[model samples]
Target: MTDPTARPADPIRPTDAEARTLARDLIAHARFAALAVLDPDSGAPMVTRIALVPGPDGVPLTLISTLSAHTSALAADPRCSLLIGEPGEKGDPLTHPRLTLQARAEPADKTALKAHYLSLYPKATLYYDFGDFGLYRFAPLAAHLNGGFGKAYRLTPADLAQ
Candidate 1:
């Protein structure tokens, strides 16, 4: 038998104005994101949920405890990915729009943004200043947007410019 490989039809559509808008909307409104990073010791993929908010300059930012596994992973390897979007309550979850961002996590100054960050997530004030916690900014390198079935587009950093 011939070698069989899975090659499904390319469902990704051309990047368009609507796709760009949807991607920006998703990125800007995301309150939380699924962060993916490589386990430093094991060299395996790991994912964890993180509270995300827009930084002073509108880049995706978050405060994370240095104790968390994901934080350690980021420290060892800044490469990471973020998935932003939540399925709607009334429809098939698979049909919901979502955006996956490939980014590099960089350390951000906590003191400069402490008050602004807390303004959006007052509850974080409890541990925001903990010595183990640090602020990180997700600098997007590229992104894939799934606007629903048959609605996919690959976007660039500019397309997601806030």
Candidate 2:
């Protein structure tokens, strides 16, 4: 006999193409994201809000200050995650789609990235050359995309890149 209260397994939405596009769009259009890093001393997880822009490889690019706690943590441990997506005001928050990316943060050539970064954040031009600030790229290793109820996918770097 079947258990009446048991919920059926959520089916994967046949929107792989769409999901891939959405994932890339999320990174491209996002102005900010929640960056989670590991604290060097305590080894506890820490999260901070950060500006987001597209990098050379359709990944995330960010400018972080060396003096900040998150930057220091990244220097010690490059592993991090970024939560991208925003919930609509009308729907159940859980029903909204979001992408969680597991990545490694590495310093990029600032000079190469400066113009691109400036185009997105023009105001940053004033402090663009600040010595304490740096350009870092997020190299996605894996990703989990929740595209609403019954819509979920585990994506790899290639999936997102395409």
Highest TM-score among the candidates is held by which one? 1
Worst 10 residues of 2 by lDDT: 9-18
For each candidate in turn, the TM-score is 0.91, 0.89
Error of 2 at 34 (Å): 0.2
Q: What TM-score would you give candidate 1 relative to the actual structure?
A: 0.91
Tens-digit per-residue lDDT, 12-78, candidate 1: 7989899999988887788899999999999999999999988867679989998899999999999
Superposed by TM-score, candidate 1 places the C-alpha of residue 40 at a distance from the truth, in angstroms, of 0.8
lDDT of candidate 2 over 14-98, digit per residue (tens): 5478889888988888878999999999999999999888876788999999999999999999999999988889979889888
Residue-level error in angstroms, candidate 2, position 92: 2.3
Error of 1 at 46 (Å): 0.4
Looking at model 1, residue 62 earns an lDDT score of 89
After superposition, candidate 2 runs with Cα above 4 Å error: 2-15
In lDDT terms, how accurate is model 2? Answer: 0.89
